[model samples]
Structure formats: structure tokens, C-alpha cells
Target: MRRASGSGAVAVAAVLGDGARYEAGRTQQTVRAGQRITVSGHGCTVRQICAYRVVLEPAAEPDKAAAAAAPSSPRPVGGEADGGFCFTTNPTVLATASKGFPPRGDTLSVLDNGGVRRFPAGLSITVSYVDTRTRTARLRGDCAAVAVADYDNARVGDTVEFAGVLFTVSGLTERAIRLKRTST
Candidate 1:
């Protein structure tokens, strides 16, 4: 074992046997395993960190004590997707339900969960609707990207729920839907 030291604001002073004095900033580090080192430098008032490795004996029977001591995986949070909605929470659902919507990095929790789920900053919609004239309703294909106007097949006065928000389709095109928010 060896002694290590670090400094905050005051410099470390060492006195020699002959009454000589040496003053310098003190910082400590572990250059290698089982060895600690301290170096003196100018204005080095930073915190000291050290790393070491521990070795445990191999278990005689793998399941005897290991299962009791092993930690179980943590439970999923409310927003975690496990065989449920792709975007579980209201805010996440809202952020992902619309195309051309900016992503707030500060609000994102899970960075990646395998497949692609990002959209460009354009008005895209996956609309399933019943034609008012013919009264026909069908589900759109998954990953079906289309303009807002095409959602209801150019129906001028139709509404759809996206991310739990209702939007009245006011105008349309092959790739864009002009929507009027009717409710919060």
C-alpha cells in the first residue's frame, strides 16, 4: 500500500530533513494496477481519481450461490415500449405522430430501440378513413408515408386522430394535409 494526496486550493508543502521546503500543487493518480502515484505541478487543484480491479474466486457450482446473489433486471418505466404502443407516453406519442416535427433531445429517453422511427419535417400522414359518400373504411399499410391531404383520400371535411390529437382535414394534396385543430 502507498499514501496518496490531492489538493483543493492550498498547495502541498514538503519539508526536507535539512529544513528545506518544497511547495507545489498535489494531485494523485493510479498509473497502473496495485500502484498509486502522486505528482506535483503548477496550479493543479483538480480532483484525484484512481481505478483498481477486484478478482473473485470462481464458483464451485454455478447455480448454488450465484442465483441468490445475482441482481435481477430492473422493471420498465411507463414510457418503455414492451409489446405495446411504439410511443408509449403522451409526449413521446405526440412528438413521433407528426412528420416534420423537431425532436427535442432533452425530452428523449430511449435513444434507440432497433428499427427506424424518425420522420422528416414535412406534413405526412397515415390516414385510415371511411368515405363519407361510399362509407368505406380501411386500415393503411404500416410505414405508409403520404401527404396530409391524401390521408382521407382528398375528403375536404374529415377528421383523424394522430398521437391522440384530433385534426380536421381542411385541405389536401397527394402528399400534404392542411389540418385545423378542433380539440386539445
Candidate 2:
């Protein structure tokens, strides 16, 4: 589960014992605070929604068999062991602020101006800019120039497709923008 940063929403991605997957664009639903959302076959109540995280209370005990079958950690992608990407506010400075720091166990790679990094698939993301408000960021497709109107209102937790790949706005701050590769 991940909070929507500025938005008071949380994205819950879960899989059930029956192999039913729940995530953004699939079984996506909006529920009020204190409401319960059932993902696949599991139910949980939204206890609190904060600036950085969402608190949830499980409605029932987990199925031991299903829990055992679940992977201990998410599989890595793009040859990244942590499966996350970080971009800092100061393109000239590297990882100077906590907000711009990469996730624990993740490596940092500073991209030069006009530089492009290719992932395992055809997905390639270029940082358009990190918002000064610290609440949003814009991603360009293959380092191409994108119009401001194209992504002016994109919020955290929003998913956008570029080429054939899907990327999720995972985290945002004044110093950094974090994106997670969803699919290709």
C-alpha cells in the first residue's frame, strides 16, 4: 500500500489466494475515510489517511496458506534490486536531501542533461521537472519534449502510460520524484 502524497487517497495493491490481483485501474474504487475496501478476497478498513501514509486495520485474519504462498519481497525490475527509481530536485547535486534520497537498498544514478536510461523493457522515463510545490512531478516519454497541458494536473499515485510501458507516481517531495515501473 502507498499513500497518494498530497491527495487523501491510498493505492492498495494486493493479491488473494485465488490469484486475483487488485490494483489501480483494476478494481479501483474510491471509499471515504473509515470505509472498508475489499481487495480480492481480503477486507481492510481505512483507519487514517495522512500526508505520507495510510493506516489500515485488517478486517480479518490472513489465510495462512495464502500468506505462505506470497513472495517475501517484490521481484526486481529494470535490473534494479529495489524496483524503484529516484530523481532529485537539483540535477547538478546528487542525493543531498532526504526527500531526494533513493529508497533503502536502492542505488542512485544521476542522469545528465538530455541523458536517457533504458529499462528492461521498452520503458524509458525522463524527468521533465520536479514541481517547486513539492507535491507533483512530470515525466516525459523517451526524453521527448512534452506540453505542459499534457500533465499539468497529474497527482501522486496517478498512473500514465508511455510507449507500451506503464509507470506509477509512487512518491513525491520538494527534492525528489519517485516512480515505480508497473508494466511494459
Candidate 3:
């Protein structure tokens, strides 16, 4: 089966001394075991390299179309300022997950995901810290980075403001900042 995007897996077909042979399109490479390499649709650490045909699993796609088709919140009669990425008739619905953030930050991977790719430098985004228990936007910010386009200005300890609330930039990447709500 073909996947619309992302990498697939590959397997070895022949044992050639120190490596195994696999055809990634027209090009062939003898990848040794334990090598960290990426082939056309395949990538990741090679768990074991031996003679077996590669089996490619289809790339998993998120069902964004359905979510996108969900009824949108109505626009205000008069636009509301300081309203960060409003999506519900109610003002407290959390958007971090639909916007591609993890349900919660285990460490800083959440920041890196947004910073390095989804919300890259120069792109303005409305950010909020959602408390998992209540799933509400505790602190919100409408922001742009002050430095280069990769969002490298965001470091582990800086802070920014949202509607008078001070949220600390808890994690970062070259293009994104991960924040946590702090008592102000």
C-alpha cells in the first residue's frame, strides 16, 4: 500500500559480506546492521539486517479533514482583541491538541515540535497554556519572535506576557517556543 506522506520501512534481500542489499527505487545500498539511515519510504535505526524482502507499511494520516469540517465558532459582532485562536462559542476550549501540540509536555519535545516545524519563525501564532485537568487556556499570548526566523530567540528560561499573565518559555527550538503558565 502507498502512503501519502512520511517514511516507510524496508527490509534486506541479500547478504553481502558486511552489509545487506535493498533497492530504494533505482538506487541500491548495502546498509550494515545498526546503521541509522533513511531510505525512500523507510527510516529509523536498523534493528536487524538480514535477508528478507522489505515490507512497507502505509504512512498513518491524522483525520484532520473531519475536524476541519466541524462547525466553526461564529465571528464576534465586534472583534475581540486579545482573543487567542478562538475556536469555540465558549472562550475556554483548548486548541493546543488540534493545533498539533501534545496533550501535555512530558519534557520539551512539545516545544521543539511547534518551534522546528509547525509554527516556524516569523509565523505569528496565538499560544495558550492548557491545563490538562480543565483543558482551558490558562495563559494566552499573541506573539512573534524577536530574533531570526527559526525562533532561536526562545530559550529555556525566558518569559512573555499574555493578557497580563506571565508565561515562561519552558522549552524551545530554532523556530518555536514552548510555554507554561506561571503564577503572576
Q: For model 2, what is the alpha-carbon lDDT of residue 41?
A: 61
- Measured by lDDT, the strongest candidate is 2
**Candidate that would win on TM-score:** 2
lDDT of 3 by residue, 68-107 (tens): 3322432222223213222212222223312333223322
Query: Taking the tens digit of each residue's C-alpha lDDT, what string does model 1 give over 1-184?
Result: 1111211122232211111123353333323322222222111121322211111122234322442231222222222221122212324333434433323221111111122223322222343443445432322212223211212232444544443344444543333334465544
* Clashing residue pairs, backbone N/CA/C < 3 A, model 3: 8-41, 8-42, 11-54, 115-176, 150-174, 150-175
Structural similarity to truth (TM-score) of each candidate: 0.26, 0.33, 0.23
Q: What would the per-residue lDDT of candidate 2 be over residues 1-184, giving only the tens digit for each residue? A: 2223334344443211212134344455555568877754678777764333344556775432332232233222433322122111122221222223334434333232333444422234455556656566555432112211123234567754333234456665555555565652
Worst 10 residues of 1 by lDDT: 105-114
Better model by lDDT: candidate 1 vs candidate 2: 2
After superposition on all CA atoms, how large is the RMSD of candidate 3? 19.4
Model 3 alpha-carbon drift over 4 Å, by segment: 1-152, 174-176
Score each candidate by Cα lDDT: 0.29, 0.40, 0.30
Clashes in model 2: which pairs?
none
Which should have the higher TM-score, number 2 or number 3? 2
Runs in model 2 lying further than 4 Å from the true structure: 1-25, 63-184
